[model samples]
Target: MLELLDLLWTFFKIGLFTFGGGYAMIPLITESVVAKGWLETSQLIDFIAISESTPGPFAINIATFVGFNQAGILGSIFATLGVVLPSFIIIVIVAKAFSKFATNKFVLGFLRGVKPVVVGIIFSVAVSFILQNVFSFSFKELGDFIFKWSTIIIFIVVFAMTRIWKKIHPIFIVLVSGIMGLIIYGLIL
Candidate 1:
């Protein structure tokens, strides 16, 4: 009971404070979940991957998974509700006031300020993930970095494919990358 309430409060706080959707929320989620010992960094990474692969919002998916992992189905319910409640309330408030505020300069300025912050958060998350998963650094040599050749190759291929065939869906890119991962890591060595 206490644990479930804790989950609810924590997720509620996460959802309330997090802006700019899931990618932007990664750092906050990492801090809260890791600090609470709810999930390790590796587990959080896995949760991120699973969340991306699954349907609905990534943050909500993570909340549900973490809740279920902690205290079963009821926990999942509480955590999900907690995470969503803030968004629901805010949307209601925003919807009611949007007409009045639509042309307000202060509100417009505030939103403009927020766009850069959201972009910065998303870029930070991207760089962190790239460093963790795609590159290795060497202590022996200053400014030396080791790259995973296979992963780099996959990245190049995916980038080229996406650029060349603009209509290709992201799922195809995911599938291709998965197959490449299997071949490179699973069967190569």
Candidate 2:
């Protein structure tokens, strides 16, 4: 019971304070989960990858993944509800109240300021992921960056495919990447 409540509160704070989408929320989620000893950095990275690839919203998926790992299905429920509730409530309120402030200078100014910060946060997270996953660079220790050939190969192939076949669906790319992973990691190495 206590764990469930903690999960709810932690995720609630994360959801309420996060201005951007899931990519931007990674830092907060990683910090909170790591501080609580609920997950290691690598595990969190894996969860992020899985969440981004899966069907549902990334925030919901991550919350559920963390929650389930902590306290089973009920934890997943509480975490998901906690993360989603704030957005739902805020959207409802904003929908009702926004018309009056739609043109207000203060509101407009606040939103304008937030846009760039969100982009920066997302960009930082993406760079961190690439550095860690592809180059095996550990930001914590400032370790020497080691090139991960398997990952680099996959990245290049997927990137080239996307650039060359602009019309191809994302799922096909994911499928190809998965096969490549299997071949590279499973069979070759």
* Candidate closest to the true structure, highest TM-score: 2
Clash number by candidate, in order:
0, 0
- Residue 174, model 2, lDDT: 65
Clash pairs for candidate 2: none
Output the lDDT of residue 50, model 1.
Answer: 68
lDDT (tens digit, per residue) of candidate 1 on 45-139: 76776666678888789889899999999999989988999989988888988877778999889889988998998897777666665665423
Over 4 Å off in model 1, which ranges? Answer: 137-144
Name the top lDDT candidate: 2
- For model 2, what is the alpha-carbon lDDT of residue 169? 68
How far is 14's C-alpha from truth in model 2 (Å)? 1.3
Q: Give Cα-based local distance difference scores for all models.
A: 0.82, 0.86
Per-prediction TM-score: 0.85, 0.87
lDDT of 2 by residue, 1-189 (tens): 999999999999989878867777888887797789988888887666676567988889888988999999999999999899999998888897787768889988988998898898888888888888788886787999887779999999898999999998656876798899999999999
Q: Over 4 Å off in model 2, which ranges?
A: 166-170
